[model samples]
Target: MMHVPPQAADARAKTGIPVLDERLRGGFPRPSTLLLFSDKPTEKRLFGENFAVQGVKAGDTSLYVDFFRAPQLARGELKRFGTIDPSKLVFVDATSSQLLLPSQEKYRISDIGSLTNIREAIVSAIEATAPSRIIVDSMEFLMDRFDKDDVLRLWHELIEAARANRAVICFLFINWTLLEEDLAQIRSMSDFVVEFQSSVRGGIVRNSMRISEMAENGIRTNWIPYAFKDLIGLTVYFPRILVTGPFNAGKSTVVRALAEKAISIDRMGTTVAFDYGNVNITGIEAEIFGTPGQERFEFIFKIFAREVSGVLLVIDATRPEELPRAKQMLDLVGPRIPYVVLANKSDLVGALSTEDIAHRMGLPSDVPVIPTVATESKGVRDALLLLAEMIIGVR
Candidate 1:
């Protein structure tokens, strides 16, 4: 027997979602099985589809076994993620009989009534195609119809086949049936488990994902908020650059200027929650989150402070007395994260110089204090670029 080393970071499959890929270090390990379980009606299939499409985008063959959706319907939905080469994707159609659609896939299950047919169709495709990646959407279709023990046995065999082929496989399942013991068995057999959850607040939907189990790095983190774009599929992304400062220091102005489209959760011209905007500049994608300047909202800092990639501390250049308060706000973001100071209102009368501002804030000599007029976007892009470079270690 020949021994094989674990997949390297660059060699791991890219999930096509930058933040998720970053959280995964690169992507799921090759020949590993991941269970995407969710009780809520979240976009679970979007994640699985993105994973399969990413493999196809990498010039590798991918297999998609559909139990709930027909082959055409699945392909159509996947196109919303990105355009893929049709030749690279092989579909195992187990729903055609139930859907009353003619089977055009490479492998077809003429009779979905029998568990043996489902198992034979999937197993044969896995062996014959030996694809680099595989996705089975809605495993509930099988578990609902077949015996639990038989389904588990077939699942284990598929896992073995994936390991032999050195392919990454993902199963999307809704947590409705199956006893707790059987669920535990399924989880134990998987290398990773990702769960999706969603909520409605103020008539707006917010989606998030939690990595419940990852055998490689064993990461267990809080629910990471995410959103989806029309053609870009699912994004488990929030590379945040926090802009915080004293009251009326143009923090919101800076956020609005940097964002292509922005919204502020303000009450009576004061941000009660936060200001958010998405920015894409020079190939660097980021989300700018501006915190409220008043000390009353200081308690809310801990909520949005996790996984901060960088910071842009905005301050009024004319108010040197508020420098300490601004420094205190920066402390809330914690140390060791790269940060740059923005002396806003530099165009105003009697504004303090960058040197004066830095000295008053007691910042180290190496920390940058850039002057800016946030309302006019003057010198704002420079401050953002500096922070971006600092985050990437290019500065």
Candidate 2:
């Protein structure tokens, strides 16, 4: 029997997308395989490239293995994001000879006879540069050229080699190009899968991302909306505080008042599942998620509560007896999660005072309870700002 030494713990890296990072816990795990699938060109590939450039900018050596684009063309595309250090960024030219005959400047060319040669070049590059991150900006082209079994063999070999050397590997695959079985196998082997989809709603293009098969402690988020800027990599739109409470507590009205554009997924004038809205304060960027107040739908709480910066607990001011139910809902999320209480419908003739509602709910002295009339948007901004402060630990 042979005794092997223990390997060091994997180092985590940031994706530079704040909201996405929050959902990912920290970032992609080091020495793990990430698959990015998309039907459209440029969208997914650019994301992978930006990730590589972000690694380089963070002082980590990164390798970009291009099987489709020329090295200079890839570099030019990357420059749109930000300035990258030439020395820290290395390119494995796998498509140059495919476009033209072999030349002196060509680093490595991908051909039928020398398919193994490309794998060797990749392994050598990893050993030589010792990069923390490597992006094979795509596996689709290689999969098309080589036999299915051979491609999988090469993929396993190269990925295992990269992992042994403690480098994270990202393989970009086009979902529509590969066979269903091949795609399924690749996804099963991958540590994370990020899928991109674009839809036209009301004549507007909306890009969203869906994440599957994440690493341990991975916080799964809903289809988060994002966009690419010329300089910034990816900017995610984060929702404001999600307002939740007992059944018929005016949660929907609160979101409608607080949000510039809001949608209520209610049933028969009462919320049954969830609500979504967008709030843009002068100095704040927030999205509001309102969970169903019905006790039957409490399971949705865990899903929405994963990355919540703070929570807003809404209570009907007229129904003081329901305060305990609201408190119980907060208790479901556990302590240490920041939350504010809203005494909604205060404009009604016999509504409870903020302090009375808080006292009845047995809330701590530090908790702030604001009186609100959700129908008129009164105190909505104030409540959200207070929740934001609590999330940031300022209040």
lDDT of each: 0.80, 0.76
Model 1, position 323: C-alpha lDDT score: 91
Report how far residue 204 has shifted in candidate 2, in Å.
Answer: 1.9
TM-score of each: 0.71, 0.63
What alpha-carbon RMSD in Å does predicted model 1 have with respect to the real structure? 6.9
lDDT of 1 by residue, 95-124 (tens): 888977787777988888877787788878
**Top-TM-score candidate index:** 1
- TM-score, candidate number 1: 0.71
Residue by residue across 1-395, what tens digits does model 2's lDDT show? 22222335746666877545544556777778888888666377767887888888888888888887778787887888878788888888887668665633324655534668888888877777778788987877876777778888888887887787677788888755666887778877888888888776558676767666565755444455556667777765444466899888888888888777888776688777788887755334667889987777988876787656578898899998888889888888779778988888999999998878877888899999999888887887788877765564333
